[model samples]
Target: MRRALAIFFVFISFQVSGQGVLDWWDQLHNYPDAAGPDRSRYINLSPGYLGPNAMIMPSLPNMTIDNEFWVQALGQTHAGNGDKTQNFFLKGNFPLARDRVMLYITSVPYETWEVTPETRDERRMMGLGGKGGNTGDVAYGVIFKVFREKHWLPFNFGFRLHTKTTTGGNLTNARSTDNSLYQWEGNFSKTMIEKEEEKLLLKASLGFVTWQTNKNRLPGGSNHNQNDAPYYGFGVEYLNRSWLLSSDVVGYTGYLGNRDYPHFFRTQVQYRFNRLALRTEYNYGLQSWDWNTFSLGVRYYILELLD
Candidate 1:
């Protein structure tokens, strides 16, 4: 594990070096705003605990992506179960009618899951004992932003509809492949504090997630009791020119009852250098079945390539 991490770091260093060269060229040419797009608009789009930026249980507004493709590579470690997961994400934004309506797509190329001894034992009890290292399912989704940011009374509101497809590896036993789901969210964000290059923002979101279950494919033929759940999240972010620090306490109540709800706390820090970003985050699950996770990742925003 240590060796693999070392190698990954080496690769990141090389990528950063290449990005630095591009940065120098952009500076020399005085590239238009398209080349060095405004970072403030996307600062809150960083990935959250479960691999997407929806806070703990739901996604909320941060910044809007205009015309860009964003790529992310994240390495995650789950402590309680001694598991490791790696994720690669690709996202693109296309203007349907500029800010009024936009189409966005996000997809996970693939994820790798490494099971620990403890997990193996648990699986063995369920007749699934085997070595770890399995490729996870590929998931892709599309987001339709219904409206641009609008001031409604004291808050700015944005609405979106998103749907995810379950396409990839094993979707049954290991659960690395999840069920398909649809979500509709209303997001609100407000600037609470502002200074020269420093600002603090508050964000909140409410949504409903309806899940599609495949009970026949599950191990032991157990019926998935998942019901439509209400998702809620609250987050705060402090941003400076080159630094971003944020924390969120978010969760959802199960449709069944209070006992079935899941909650989590997440924190993240990011450093930006031109168009390259380095980030790290930690998440603590507040529920019985949830696992605590830590992740390190990097993001590169390509504004001119697709434009």
Candidate 2:
């Protein structure tokens, strides 16, 4: 069994998911007194993001869609043990409501098996069939400018609602399988002040989710977790030609769910050249379950292929 587990981990590379997500941490770190997001700072208006970027970004005016694929390898093993794991996530995002709303649908199906080695008899082990999960999530929101202060302080606000796994996933304990948390989440973020190089922010959100088992769809056979989470953000930007770098985070608060509190920290760099733009970010998490991560992504202007 140990031999088999070793082979399985080798077959799946573990370094694919270099960048993870810590949502809304950047906003709360700055503008520590606002509570809304505007226009393009979120998924509703932007193309694709694994983690929150910064408070300064907003959505584009036109509707757009982005296809994102992650090739990740996950497994766990200890000396003289046969425990193993593997998983993957792929999704596409598109905007609606004239680019003010957004939807995301994806699937993650994987196979895993584990074993416990023994000293006396031959090793006895446990293994699950290659059963995984399929998940679908949708969100919608709108943003607008609240006030335009001259030269020093400007305010922006946004409202967003999210529905989780309104569609798919099977029951298993192998990979990225969401058992349909038919829950709703509402969030708001705000920027209270901003200038050419400094900024401040505030944000809040509430979530309610009911997760019923597939075998029993009734009330008692389900689990629900709901909470109100809030945080604040502060940041500064240093401009170098067409490139900019920003850092921000919120401290001392969180959703207090399975993850940890005061969850925050995200830094991003954005560069523009003609009609092309590129972005890269490194995010730090206060949660114990995750490690610091980063990613690089790009956008291109294919006007030659446009209508």
Q: Relative to the true structure, how large is the alpha-carbon lDDT of every model?
A: 0.54, 0.32
Q: Write the per-residue lDDT of candidate 2 for residues 163-204, one digit (tens) a residue.
A: 344332222221112323232333343455556755444444
Provide the clash count, candidate 1.
Answer: 2
Model 2, stretches more than 4 Å misplaced? 1-141, 149-154, 162-171, 174-241, 250-257, 260-262, 301-307
The runs of at least 3 residues in candidate 1 whose Cα sits more than 4 Å from the true structure, single-residue gaps closed, are 1-59, 63-68, 81-108, 114-128, 137-152, 214-226, 257-260, 304-307
- Distance from true position, residue 29, model 1, in Å? 67
Give per-residue CA lDDT, model 1, range 57-155, as digits (tens): 333445343454556666766544444555554545555544445565665555555555454433321113323333433333333444334443455
Question: Model 2 Cα displacement at 241 (Å)?
Answer: 4.3
RMSD of each: 18.6, 17.0
Strongest candidate by TM-score = 1
Pull out the clashing pairs in model 1.
54-58, 54-59
Worst 10 residues of 2 by lDDT: 45-54
